[model samples]
Every structure is written in structure tokens, then in C-alpha cells.
Target: MAEQKERDRQEDDRSSPLIDQYTARNPEQFARNLARAMEELGKVAAAWTQAREKGEASDVSAAPIADMIKTFSRVSEYWLGDPTRALEAQTRLFAEFMGIWANAIRRMSEAGIPDHAEAPASDKRFQDPEWGRNAFFSFLKQAYLVTSRWALDLVEGADGLDLATRHKARFYMEQVSQALSPSNFLLTNPELFRETMASNGENLVRGMRMLAEDISAGRGDIKLRQSDASQFKVGENIAATPGKVIARNRLVEVLQYAPATENVLKRPLLIVPPWINKFYILDLNPKRSFIRWAVEQGHTVFVISWVNPDERHGTLDWSDYFEEGIRFALNAVEKATGEKQVNAVGYCVGGTLLAASLALMAAEGDERIATATFLTTQVDFTYAGDLKVFVDEEQIAALDKVMQGKGYLDANRMATAFNMLRAGDLIWPYVVNNYLRGKAPLPFDLLYWNSDSTRLAAANHSYYLRNCYLENNLSHGRAVLGGKKIDLGAITIPIFNLAAREDHIAPAKSVFLGSSFFSGPVEFVLAGSGHIAGVVNPPVSNKYQFWTGAKPAGELESWITNAQETGGSWWPYWQTWIEKQDGERVAARKPGGKKKPLGDAPGDYVRIRS
Candidate 1:
């Protein structure tokens, strides 16, 4: 035992030298860097103040902080109102802490003891080797995990709260826990501490400067930079697919890509992407460009580039989107290709619009669209994911008033909400990297496209929230559009519905549930990964797998249990499905058949950053 103690002392001595190698060696330099960081922080504060004066920062009244507090109070009432229950909750937490303390003590007495509490393997925040190797960090990590789980369990076990209130409480709790993570702070995070010590606090100086610049860019708010924005441009490298704008309208520009094959399908493909984001997500680059691949697969593709709406478009509602957006594109495709019937594709909210438009077409005896494809789209919001937390009547009313004042919801507002959905992945990591660790994120095309947000018009956004999310009208055959009641059963067109297994924006279960609403035979395919990667997966990458099985009948889990997994990208599978619908071919047509070309593909509207 004495020899073992000597060996342990030697190990500690060896580690001390190694740690000293990264410690601040020059006090003068460290002082200078600290002073510079302070100056940068001052600038950050000033920029925020200036933004507030200019009304560029977030409006306090418009924020949901109050709503969060109100919901949390209800949770508090559940726990605190009952002495026994409060004691039980406290006792449970105390017991967990005691267990963790016992484990820590055991770890000290015996070197090989495992952690009492461990983060999931997939959690990147706790991936640093020091988090496990260092006793202090390990204990801190376990304590945090235990507390966070306990807080969440309290919300789950709480009574007297409606589903909406409970959901809000849970989401709010997650956000708070994520924000307060030890990994977010330099002192608690071993990696950040080491980085700061090694660089003599220079990292913090750089980080503060970047923070000030980002705040200024956000007009007094911190517009977190998720990627190196300098490395990407719209037409230059990112959305550089060869195509031309064959038609233009107030709401959309119909971009028809140049043919990449000798022969093309008879029916031109029209894609109605969500107006909440640019159409370039489908055409990020040639490597990941779904549009380019489809064009190469002997199909003429036309995509709608929605205008970044300002106050001028505030009054535009779903009808305008249907008529001027979808209907206009269908008319343009007919003029461009001389084909009245075309295959249609819609992504996310775009799919929702397409589903409604198809119903309207059925009612009007218009059969322009031959088939429909929905990508991570939700027609039924019954099982919609975390996004539902934001859609109660009270919140919607408040949002409506805010939109009325500004004519549209700001891009940052929408971006923030989306970021909050995965705050652990999206928000906190960026906060630590950009502000705490003082590092710029690597250039990523997907993140770049994600950062390029679009504004939501008041009337249109309000109608969508109230109808789709709040009321779930589209699925119930109660949705009234353009003074006509929409019936999903009336539209019997063949439908290809795709859902990502790990998609948060649109859950797989929700998509499966939605598939049942369509009267037509729906070919439901489940792809691996989240909303973006799952849909944009190309054949060459050979990354994730996709699953196919019996029609989307019964529960999602049951269907998945009976499903067959296909390796590689779902792109080829989708191509085969497309061909199954219509295999007739014709000579490949140029950008514009009859209509004149306005400009290059990825049109002018997409270039307009909000």
C-alpha cells in the first residue's frame, strides 16, 4: 500500500508538469489579453445598448420569457403547493446526490470504479477525455446530469398542468439546464480552462471581439455564427447549379435547371420549397445538390424561389401562396415544357401548401399535378415534435400582435425558435465555441444555409399557425382556403411521402399519421438521420441507410419493426420510385421551352438575404 501511494504521488507529479506546460507562462501578456478582452466586452455592451435605442434588439414585450415564467410557476405550484410532494421531490434529489457522492468517494478509494452518472455516448459536450479522466470534472459532470434529469422528471411527474403547459415547462426546463451546463463555462470546462491558460487568455480576447462583431451584425443581439460565412456565396459556389429563371411572379421565381441528360421525363418536376427558408437548401452544392441529381436523372426540374417578404407582403395569406406561388409555377411549367400534368414535390411547410393546393385543384377540377412527393412534411400536426410548444392560442395571439406591428416575424426570431428546439446541439455549442472558447466554427454549407433565414409575413404566418399547428385543420377536412373547404380525401393522386427517422422538425410518427389522411396510395419511406442530411443524402456518399416496408399502416414502431433496411443513400430508391410513376422519355429540353429565360438559376429572390 505504501509503494502504491508512492507510485500515485509520482503520477501526480508527472501530471503537474504536463499541466504546467499549458499554464499561463507570462503574467504581463496574460494581463494585456485580459485588458483587451475587457475592452471588447465593453464594445459588446455598447453595441447592445445602441441596438436597444434603435429598436433593433429583441423586444422584451414580444419575448416568451413571461410565458416561460408563468408555465414554470404552475410546475412550482404542483411541487411546492403540496408539502409531501415537495419533500418527496427533494428527498429523491438528495438521494441521487448521495449516491453520486458515494460513488465519488469510492472512485477516490479505488481507482477503477465507474461513474455513478454518465452522459449518453452521443453527447458531444462531454466528449473531452479530461471529463472522464479528471476526478473533479467527472464529479461535476455526474452532478449536473443527475440534477438535470431530476428537474425534467419533476416536470413529467407534475399534476394539474395541461399538456400544453407541461410541454412548455419541459422545454423551458431543458433550455435552462442546457444553458447552465458546466461545459458552457470556462472555469467548469477543463478544455476551455486549458485553452485559456495555454494562450494566456488570448482566446478569450479573440472570442470577445468576435462576440462584439456578431452582436453588431445582429443589430444589438448576438447573431451566433454557426459557420464561416466568408467561405460561401449564393451563385458563385453554393447554389451554382446550371439553370435559368423561366418565369417570375410577386411571390415566386420559377427556376428551370439546364438538362444534364440526352433524354428527360415527359412531365417536368416542380418543387415548392418552404417560404420560411430559401430554395437553395436543395441545391447547396453539386455534391449535395438534390436538384442537380434530379436534373441528371433525366427530369427537367423547376423550383420556386420565394421572396423574402417585408411589410409589403404582410397581407399575403395561404391563398396567395396557392394561386401566385404553386398555381403560377404550374402554369409556368406548362408554358415552359408544354406539359399540363407534372410531378410535384414539396419540402417541410412547402409540402403542407402543396397538400392543400392539391385539394383545391381537386375541388376546381384542375388536374395539373399528376403525382405528389412530400419531404419531411407534416399535414397532421397531432404528433408534431417540440415545435408544438410554441403554438398555443395565447402565444399565437401574442405573435399575431407582434407581426402586426412589424408586418412580419423577424428572421432572427424564427431562427432563435428553431435553435431552441435543439439548444444542446445548436445553441450551447456555438455559445461555448464562439464566446467561451474563442473559436470560429468551421465552414459548413448546411449550417450556412441554416443561418440564411427568411421572414414570415404577418397574415400568412398567422393563418398557417392558427390553421395548421393550432387547429390541425388540413388533416380534419376543415381547412378553408380561398373560401373553399379543403378535403384531403378528394385528392386521390399517387403520393410519395418521405420521413426522416430522427427528424425533430417533422417526426416520423407524425408523417406516418399524415400519410393515412391522403386518399391516394401513399408510398411511405423512412430515411436515417435528421431532416436535412436524410433528405439531401446522395448515392456517392454512401452514408446513412433508408427503410421501406408495408404502407404506413399501424404505429410507426410496428411498421419499422417489419421494415427492411436498405444500405446507402435513399436518392436511388427515390429515383426508382419516380420512374415507377412515369417512365416515358423525350428529347432533353433546354432551360426554357416556350417561355423566355429571365436570368440564371437560383434566381434573384434567393440572393436577397433577410
Candidate 2:
């Protein structure tokens, strides 16, 4: 026993030197880094203060946080108002804690004691081997998992809350649980602890410095770096598809991509991408560029590249978008290609606008658009996913008030909201990597495009929120644009509505439900991925599958059950469909056939950063 004890002591002493060596070798450098980190932190504080003073900081009165508190208060009232219910909740939690404690005791006493709690297999936060192998960390992980599940259960079991309130409570509970996960903390996370010790606290120093830099980049807010921004340039490597800006308007620049084939479809293709994000999402890189791929398929593609709006464009509304953006692009396409009949594609919010525009054009007897395609777009906001949580009346008013001040919503505000929707995936990982591990994220083109957000004009955004999300007017035919009520039924042109199965922004069910509103023969395709990936998926990648079976007449589940699943990208399938609509070939037309070329493929408008 004495010999075993001496051996264990020696092992401990040997391990100590590994950690001690970093401090001994670089004590002065560590001190200097720590001092620099402190200075950066001070700058972060000052920047925050200045932003608040200038009224540039996010409004604390926003409903997300406030509604979370209010909803939880109602939950508390439900539990606390009845002593028995509160006692039951307490007893349940207490029992779980007791079970964990007993297991922990057994673990200390014996060699192998089964965990009393286990995080879900899909939960990446507890993936570290030490979280399960080490008794101390295993206990902490299990305890945290147990407590968080209990908290969520309480919210789920709570009575007397409306559906909206319940949803808010659940979302907020998730946010809190994710934020408070043991892995987020320094000592609680085994990986962070090991890295800090190995580096003699230099990791934290570097992390603090990065935090300061990110805050500065966001202009007082932390613009979480998901990818190395330094690695991407808009026109050089990304959005590098050969094309020319044939037309430019105050709101949009119409880029006509050069044809890759000798002949092209007689009917031109116009893409209306959402202004909330840059058009480069579709043209991220040649490998993933949908625009480039479409051009290679022998189609004249004209994409509307919306200008990142500012105070100057605040007064622009949906009508302006319809007229100056879509209408102007249509007119430009005609002038460039001399084609009156054109096939149009709209993505996300852009699709929503295009649907409304079609309705208005129907009312005005304009039949220029021959066919329409919607990509992960939701006309009906009924099952709009978590985004609806931010669309209540109180929140809209608050957002409007903030937008009114600047004439446009800040890009970061929207980016943060989108990130929050998938906080477990998009947010906390970056928080751990960039700020905890003190490591720079690797360069990823998709992530770089995601980070490049765009501001929304005040009038346009406010109208969209009130009409689409708040009222669900577009689906119901109550949406008014250009002084005409929007009736999706009036859009009798053949429609191709694509919905991502895993879409959060525009849920598949929502899109399926929306397909029924169109009087045309709507072919709803369910792609097997999220919003961006499912749409941007090229045939060469063969990454995800897509489904197509029946018209979206029945429940989404029934359609999904009856649908035929096909492997590989849906791009070729869509191309076949487009050809079926109009297969007539014409000599490949040059960009800006009649009009003067404004600039290169990704024009000056896309170069504007928010």
C-alpha cells in the first residue's frame, strides 16, 4: 500500500510539471498578454458606453427579453399560486437531485457507478470524453443535464398559459439552459481548463482580446466571428461568376450572367433574392454558386442584387421593391434580351414579395411573368417556425420605433435574431471556439456569406412584418401592395414551390400549406436540408435528397409519406422542370445586349457592407 501511494504521488508530481512549465518559461510574456487583454476589455467597455449614449445599442425594451420575463412570471404565478403544484414541482426536482447525489456517492465509493443522468446523444456540449470518464466532471454534467431538463419540464407542464406565451417560455427556457450549460464556463469545461492550464492562462488572454476586437467590429455589439472574414473578398474569390450589371436602380442592380453554352433558353430567368442578405448567397463560390450552375445549364440568368439600404433608402417600401426592384429588373431583362415572357425565381422573403407582385400584376392585367419558382419561401406565416416569436404586436412596435430613428434596421440586430433561432448550433459553438478556446475560426465561404448581413429599409421591413408575419395577409389574400389586394389564387402561372425539410426561417409545413393557396398547378418539392444548403445544393455535390410526389393538397405528413424520395441535388430536377416549361433554344445572348454594362458580375451595390 505504501509503494502504491508513492507511485501515485510520483504520477501527480510528474503531471504538475507539465502545467508548471508554461508559467516558468513564459511568465513575462504571459503578464504582457494579460495586460494587453485588460486594455482591450477596457476598450470594449468604453465602446459599449459610447454606443448606449449615442442610442446605437439594441433596444433593451425589445420584447424577446421582456416577453421572456413576462411569460415566465405568468408561469411562476401558475406554479406558486397553487401550493400543491409548486410542492409537486419541488419534490420532482428534489427527487432527481437526490438520485444524482446517491449515484455520485456510489461512484466515489465503488469503481463503476452508472450515471443517474445522461445528456441526449445529439447534445454536442457534453461530447468531451472527460465529461463522462472523470467522476467530478461526470457528476457536474449529469447534474446540469438533470436540472435543465427539470426546468424545461416545469415550463412544459405549467398550466394557464396561452400558446404564444407557452412558446415564448419554452424558447426562453432553452436559451437560458443553453447559456448556463456547464461547458460554457471555464472550470466546468474540461477542455477549456486543460487548454488554460497548458497555456498558463494565455488562452483566456487571447480570448479576451478577440472578444474586444469582435465588439469593436460590431460597433459596440459582439459580431461573433463564425469564419475568418479576412480570407474572403466579394468579387475576387466569392461571387466570382462572370457577368455584367446591365441595369442599375436606386434599389437594385440587375446582373446578367454570361452564358456558358452556345445556345440558351429563349425565355430569360430572373432571380429575386432577399435583401436581408446579400445576393452573393446564391453566388457564394463557383463550386456552390447556383447562378453559375444555372448559367452553365444554358439559361440567361438575371439576378436582382439589392443595395444594402441605409438612411437614404428608409422610405422605400414594398411598392418600391415591386416597382423599382422587381418591375425594374423585368424591364431591364426585356431591354437586355428582348424577351417579354420570363421565368422568375424568388428565395425566402423575396419569394413572398414575388407572390404579392404576381397578384398585383394579375389585378393590373400584366402577364409578363410566365412561370414562378419559390425557394424555401413562406407565403403563409402560420407555421413560420421560431421567427414568429419575434413578430408580436408589442415587438413590432418596439422594432418600428428603433427603425424610425435610423430609417433602417441595423444588420447586426437581424443577424442576432437569426442566430438565436438556432442558438445551440450557430451561437454557443462560436462563443466557445472564439472566446473560450481563443482560437480563430477557419475560413468557410458559406459562413462568410452568412456573416455578411444587410440592413432593411424602415418602411419596407415594417410593412413586411405587419402584413406577413403579424397578420398572415399574403396567404389569406388580404395583403395590399401597389393599391391592390394580393390574391395568390390569381397567380395561375405554373408554380414550383421548394421547401426545405429542416428549414427554420420558412418551415416546410408552412410552405406546403401555402401551396394550396395558389390556383396554379403548384409542384411543392421538399428538399432534405436547411434553408441555405437545400437551395444552394448543386448536382455535383450530391449532398442531400429531395422529394416530390403529389400536389400539396393534404397534410404535410401525408404528402411526405406519399412522396417519392430521390437522392442527390434537386438542381437537375429543377432544370428539367424549367425546360419542360419552355425548351425553345436561341443563340446565346451577350450581357447588356442593348443597354450599357454598368460593371462586373457582382456590382457596386453588393460591395456595400452594412
Candidate 3:
């Protein structure tokens, strides 16, 4: 036993060289610091001793009391006199338990378990008392691990110590690194993060969001929607292209996309796309573009393409979109195909514009819209998500001052706002993955498209926020559109409204509110993904699941319940609804047109970025 003790002491002497190197730069200072830490740890030992003495006086098993006292004694000795490896082992065991608790938060969040924003934190946070054992233990373990890693690294290439001591230092260091890893942090706020505006809470939430980006969380196992097609032909194209372009703007380049089939519904179809973005959302990729589906289903499809604004078109506003957009497009479509009336489908902000156009058209006794499909669009904006908290009288005033100098809102600014919304998924995960993990981000097609953002006119954005969202003018029956006093009651068309269950941008409840203004029959659908994915869903993948049952009781609550609960894209279901609305025809028209030449039905605009 005496010889074994001698060997152990000899091994300790060899590792002393690395220990000296680490503390050499400030040996006296480090020793002083270590002494202070030991003094504090000794206090913990004293309390554990008191508890043990009390337990020993009783008939109960004092084993738990004895163990805790030993742990505190071990920690106190290491920081002061001994500085051995055994203390670190106990610290690590305690830390593993806390880490298991931290990761549990994310699992709970993904499962939609509501957080206790109002719940008080555990009494373990009372650090001045013995109750703080949990917090104190966690802090101690974390520090121990950090020291262990550096100590291990120090001994890795050293010449002196036996293999076991070197291994002890190395193992502790690795264990410390794992304990201090950034992944161990929780990625959430008190749920109040969503309600925060210009406060540091927003910053905290943004920081958490940045940490929880899609990449950091690991690639989602959910499949993406895909489709396969062998040929492309509008049934009417067999003989000649039957679609017509009523209007074409060299200045705006807003091509009107409309098709002519064998038996057109008594009324034609007109589309309104948001100017903040180009109109191609209705005509995205071939297999899933709403316009492509519309054409194949035998309906006349017309889409408006907005000219991407640069330094030149920056001055454009609400009037230009009305007179030159809807009015011009309407006349052109009417003259080209000679249709007396047409139905309209508007998406996002475009639907708001469509609301104005319909109100004005109705006021003028020029009611032509037979039915309208507002896909994830909103006319009422009492609660426009986090977008509301960011832009109000003050923020808009500042933005207006900046935009006035440039003549329009920079597209990059719009991108920045959206980036703030999903900062976790869209922005920061890559930062951790790159700087800390030493890896590049995975290339995701949706992220690529999201990164491809566009600018909107300053006048339009300012007007849109103040009049539409902040003031809630459209829904209040207190706005004007195209020289007509606006009244939503004037909109008398069959309404098909849609939104998504998980859409952070346009929550389904808000979208469902639009039904209140309309006296006509209304149908609302809530899809299963976020904003973009839910809208562009395709049946090729079961990634999307939809509900299509009874109509919602109140557009909001019913929206949550009424979804018939179908899996995959809602595209096929939408097509079926369209076909059912119109009578059937035996033959489809030929593929050509007069003075039109069937020049690319969707046109080249759909192929370009905003």
C-alpha cells in the first residue's frame, strides 16, 4: 500500500509540468482565484455536513445526506488543496441530468405543448440559500468541464505523465466541451416574444430564433411536394391556342394571362397578384402553378404581371395599380375575348387590391366579378402578426422619411423585415453551424427562393400599412378606392378564402375575418404548412395534409375544425371545386388564336424573378 501510494504521487508529479504551464502566466493570481472558489465550495460542504448531522440524529437512512456532503467535500478539495480528477467525475454526472432537461424544451415545443409564460421559475434559482443546489451544481459542473478540456489538451503532447493521468485530463476536457456546447441552450422566449415590439425582448426572441434555425435543428424528415408530367398541352390547344391577351403594357409589362376553352362559364376569370411581388405566384412552377391547374381544368385564366420597380418606377402608387392595372387589364381581356363578365382570384396583398377594385366596380354599376378566390389573403388587418408590432405610427414615420429620399421602399428592406420574422430558421443557424461547427449551410431550394426577395414602392408600402393594417380601414367600411367610397357590402361575389394552420405570417384566424364583410356564401380552408409551402402544395408528396369538411362556424374557429382533413396538396381539391362550379363540355378548343398567335400562354414573365 505504501509503494502504491508512492507510484500515484510520482504520476501526479509528472502532470504538474502541464498544470504549471497553464497557470504560469498568472500563477499567484490563479492560485488566489482558486483559493476563493474553494472557500465558497467549503460553505457548501458545511451546509451538507449540517444536513447530514441532522439526518444522522434520525432513524432514516442518511446515505443521501452523506453522498451530498462527500460531493461538496470533493469539490472543495480539488479547487484548494488536492486539485484531482475525481471531483470532475462527480460534476459531470450532475451536469448530464440538467442537459437532459434543457433538450426536453424543444421536444415539447415541436409537439405544440403550450409553454407556461406565466409560470414561476423553480426555487432552485435562490442562489443565496441551500435551495440553490440545483443552480450551484449546474454552474460548478459547467466550469469544471471547461477546465477539464483545457487541462486534457495541455497533457495530450506532454512527455512526463503516465498514460492514465494524461487520459484523465483529456477525457475531462472532452466532457467539458460537450457540457459547454451551444446546443445545450434552449431556443425559446416566454411566448411573449411574439408580442414584443421595439424592446430587448424582441432581440432576445430574435437571438433564440437565430439559434434554432432549420439547419441547427437538423434537416426536417418531412418530404417535399414533387410532381411528374410527360407532355404539356391545353386541351383547347389541339386545334389552336384559345387563350387571349386583352391588354399588354410596355411600360408596366403586366401581361394578362387568360385562356379560352370550348364552353366558357358564363363569366370569364381575372386574376390580381400582389405588386409587392410579381404575379407569378399564381403561375409558379408548371406542375403546381395555380394558373397551369386552372387552364388544364378548362377555365379561362388571366393573371396580371407587375413591372419590377427600379429607380424609374419608384413613384408608382395605388392609382397606377388601379387605373393602369385592373382597369387596363379588364378592358384588354374584355376586348380580346369579348367576355361580358369575369371571375377573379387574388392572392395576398393582391386580394386587398381586388377588394378595392370590386367595390369601385360595384359602385360604378360595372359589377363583372362572378366569384372570387382569396388564397391566404387578407382585407382585414386588425392583427397582422408580428408585422403589426414592428410598423405603427412611429416606425412608419421613420420609414416614410427614408423612403421619401429614395422614392420607393428598397426590396432589400422588405427582405430584412421577413428575415426578422423567421430569424432562427432563415438567418442565424448558419452562423453557429459555420463559425462553431466548421461547416457550410445545406442548399435548400425553398430557402434559395426565400432569399430571392424583391422591393415594393415606398408610397405603396406606407399607404398599405397606414390605411390597411394599422387603421383597419378596409374592414371598418371607412376607405376609398379609385374615386369611390368603399363599402365591403358592395362585394357580392361567391367567396373561397384559404389560409394555413401554421402560417406565422397570416394566421388563419386573421384570414378568416374577411368573411365578416361579405354577405355572400363563403368557404374557408386551412392547409397544413407555413405560408409558402402550404400555398404551393402538390399531391405528389404526402408532406401536406388538408382539412375539407363542414364550413367553419365562425371563419376562424371553423377554419381550424372544418378542414376535410386530406393529406397532400390542396391543389387537386381546388381544381375539383372549380370544375364542379361550371357545366361540362364535350370538346376542348384548338391551340391558336386571332391577332394573339398563342404566344406562350403563361408568358416569359413567370420565368423571371421579381
Candidate 4:
């Protein structure tokens, strides 16, 4: 209770601000932004001139220039060619709001009472007491949101635009609409106004300091989180599950988590996490830690903690990740456990790699995997959700140029792209709280983990995006990794496919498509949450639910119709499934017999931050 009070005080103190201060400084800030943008543009122009003068303006450079111009032209024509269209949309929106108001007033007069309408569950802007208890502001808030929605639809409905182009436009439109909402401003938000008055402008001073720090940190474009580096540390309090790094290679570190039970399964469980982020996501905390839970469930669990890549690691491709990363860990696990067969689990891109590895192993007639579990993994890229908008020939070419310069994709660049996918939730909220309301960021373990992202090697990133996102080769059995063509249908092992219903990266439907390629029995489960929460769900929380069905081979719609709802975590169900696949129970063994314990569970690789 005392800690809660302290947090509340921090929030109130942080949130005190003024519309006056913002309005007063708006002109100066705009001028500064404009000047910096012009300076950057001038630098680019100078570089282009220097390149041409030095005879370095080859066809490669010229092609990107030409393509960029073409894209600009097409986009300009789509939105700017019909200037009257946007104005007409605004007019129509005003007319609709007026009509709504008139109808509401007439109904109230006839009924001789107030007629209140419920707000949409997704819209929290009008949830404030000022908007809900006050009928006038309530109607105004609804009208504003309705107009915002209509404006977005108008932009998205532009004719002759590609799906990718449409999505990109809508994304920006939503950002602007969300930012300009009345709830974000101090003058409009009654609660914020009250706090500002009470604090007597100290929040504004603190907010300015916060803005300056962000500018210093080179993340002024968007304030993603409020917490500083001092807020949390890894391995001590956060990723502190008991384990040992039993094996290590250049590409991966194999973490053998200490068994939490007296008796363990015959087959060990190997986890393949995505190389895009640190592996501690699975071992986040004891309560929500999936690795700790798996160990407690009587499984000899091991996970691969991928190396945070730098320029030197740029040449490493998908094959290196397969052979040196997953395969190396697999070999070490087999040597240590004396178990030929294993239960493999993969999450996100790691899941994709696992599926590919299993297929390649299957092709070699090496059936070492007894059961394969995929969490939010996509073998088929068709309908890959919002991420598809950023993948295309032109986008890939531009990204290549950036990667070639740096030898790897910047961590911030990748983080920004993912944040853009859910701008309303991830991007704009921080913008309002940090910039407008002048509030310090709340300390969230998940957000801290999110901010602690890793870099991707240039060649590895390029190959994965081109082959998986653009060509759709993996699902079609045409993607060649480690000099072998991987066929998903080749793996006939019992599969447990888990997908987040609201996953933006790997849509549930796209994940379900993998089941169609498998010949063996599949138990498809759909968990109720987004990407991270669905996978990290622990039964002790009893929060998010999951749905399971036997008809994994059927269409996604049919499976949903036939699926049964379970009111707890999907971990126990997975435990039972893996138990059936395991050989016989044996006494729990300690880590590192065949291979010596390298260090602690997370290892040195995970500690290397970009």
C-alpha cells in the first residue's frame, strides 16, 4: 500500500502541466524542428553532389534515387491530386455530428430525460469523469472520435492505391488523430488541469527536463518508455531464474535451467527464442517465467540465448543461425542428457527457425524431435498481418543501403518499426504522457524488456525478409538453408501450435496454415491475448484464457467453431501433451556432464547490449 501511494504521488507530480506553457513554446519548437530538418536535407544534397563529382554515382545509387522519386510522385498524386476530397470529408463529418446532436436533443426533449449511449470498449479517450458524467462533453467526445474515424476511412478509401500503400497512409492518419484528441491536451483534460493547478507548474519544468534528456538520448521522435536504466537490472532481480550456461558457441549460448522437480522427463526440452531480441523474455521473472515453469513441470529444459550481433557478425545468414545456433544447442543437449529425441519449442521468429530446422533434420532422416511446439510462429507469410506493409522490393532495397552502411540494422530502427505497427497503444500514449502531460514513465518490466532490444546482422536480416516476407519461399518448400531445401510436410511428428489471437506480427490464421502441411496429429490452441502476454501467461495468474481443438487440420474458422474454451493458462495443457511424447520418467539430473557449465543461465552473450 505504501509503494502504491508512492507510485501514485509520482504519477500526480509528473502529470501536472499547462496548455499555456505548451502554447507559448510551440512556435519556437516548430522553428527549431524546421531548421534541423532543412539542415539534414542540405547535408543529403551535399553528399549527393560529392558522390556525383567523385564518379561514385553508379547504377545502384541511381536506381534507388529513381525509385524513391517514383514512390513520392505516386503518393503525392494519390493524396494531393484531389485536395477538395479531404475538405469535403471534413464537411461531411461536421454534418454527421450536427445530425447526431440534433437527434439526441430531440429524443431527450420527447423522453423528458437524458439518454446516454455507451462508449466503445476500444476507445478510452472519453472514459474520464468529465466526459462521462457531463452530457455535453460526452456527446462532444463521441462526435470528435466519430469524425476522426471518418477522416481515417476517407484516407484509406483512396482509389487506385495498393494495400500496402493504404495501410501506411492509415497508420500515419491514426497517429495524427490520436495525438490531436482532446484527452491529450492539458486544457481539455479536466483531471490533468486539476493536477496542473495543484502542482503550480513544477510538472512543466520537469517535462522540459524530460524532453531535453530525450533529445540528448537521440530518441526525441517518440518517448517509448518513462523508466531510466537505473530502474531495472537483468540477472539479479529480473531474469534471475536458477540455471547455468552449460555450452557456448560464437552464435549461441545454451542455457540449461536447473530442474525444479525430483523426477524429470526422459527427453529434454530445447527452446529457440528469436534472435531479434534477448532470450531473457522467456525467463523474465519467477512468476511469469515460462522457462522456470517448464523446469518445475519436470522437464529438462534448455534455451538458446542468441548473441547480440555487431558489424563483425553482419555476414552471418539464416544458415549460421540454424547450424551454429539451434543445431549446436541441440547437439549439446543430446550429449549432456544422453537422449536422442527432444521436445523443441520456438517463439516468434525462433519458431520459424525451429520449423525449418525440424524439416531439414527430417529430410536427412534424423527424427530426433518427438514433438514440436510453435508459439506465434508463421511458416506461411501469406496474410502476415501489419508487418507486410513494410516489406517490398523498394523498401528492402532502401533497407539494404542503410544496413550496408552500418553492417547491421540499428536496434532503434527495428524497435521504431514494430512500435509503428501499434502506434495507438505503443507510440502515442507515451507521446501524450511524456510530452503533453509531463509524466515520468511508469516502471513496467515488460516495457523495460521491450526497450532492451538487440541488433540484426545485415545479410541475415536481408535473407529472412526477402525469402520469408517477400518471396514466401519457406511455406512453399523452396527456401534453402544450410544447403538444404526445407519441406514442412516432411516433419510428421505430433505438433502443438499455439497462436495469439491478436498477434500483429504473425496473425493466428497464418500460423494455423502450418498445421495443414503436417501429416501427424496437431493440437492447435488459440490463446486470448497479443503476442507476448499469450506466450508468457502463467496459470497462477488465472488471467488470460485459451481455446483448444482437435480439428487442427480444419480451416481456422471451423476450428474456432469447434474449439472449447479453457479459463486458465495454456502451459498445463502443453505440459500434458509433452508428457505423452516423453519416453519414461527418470531422476532429475544436474546441469553439465558432457559439457562443463560455462557460466550463469543468461550468460555473457545476453549481457552484450547494442
TM-score to native of every candidate shown: 0.95, 0.95, 0.59, 0.83
Which candidate number has the best lDDT?
1
lDDT string, candidate 2, 1-610, tens digits: 9869855644453356434522334567657766877777787798777878877776634567887788889889989999999999999989998998898888887886668998888989988667876777887898888889999998898887888788888888988999999899878987777665556567777788898888877777888899999999999999999999999978999999999999999999999999988998999888889999999999899999999999999999999999999999999999998899999999999999999999999888999999999999989888888888888888898898889888999898899889998999999999998887888999999989889999989999999999999999888988889887779888899999999999989999999999988898988899999999989899889898999998788799999999999998999999999999999999999999966799898999998987
Kindly give the number of clashing pairs for every candidate.
0, 0, 30, 1
Q: On residues 37-107, what C-alpha lDDT tens digit does candidate 4 reach at each position?
A: 44544544555455446543323334434543554455557656777865776687877778667757776
Residue 255, candidate 2: C-alpha displacement in angstroms: 0.2
RMSD of each: 4.7, 4.7, 21.9, 6.4
Which residue pairs of candidate 4 clash?
226-441
lDDT of 3 by residue, 127-218 (tens): 21211122333344334444444345344534454543343344334434443433333221111111121122223333333323321222
Candidate 1 least-lDDT 10 residues: 6-15
- Output the worst ten-in-a-row residue range by lDDT, candidate 2: 17-26
**Residue 306 displacement (Å), model 3:** 0.9
Question: TM-score of model 3 relative to the true fold?
Answer: 0.59
Segments of candidate 1 deviating more than 4 angstroms: 1-23, 60-63
Q: Regarding lDDT, does 1 or 2 come out ahead?
A: 1
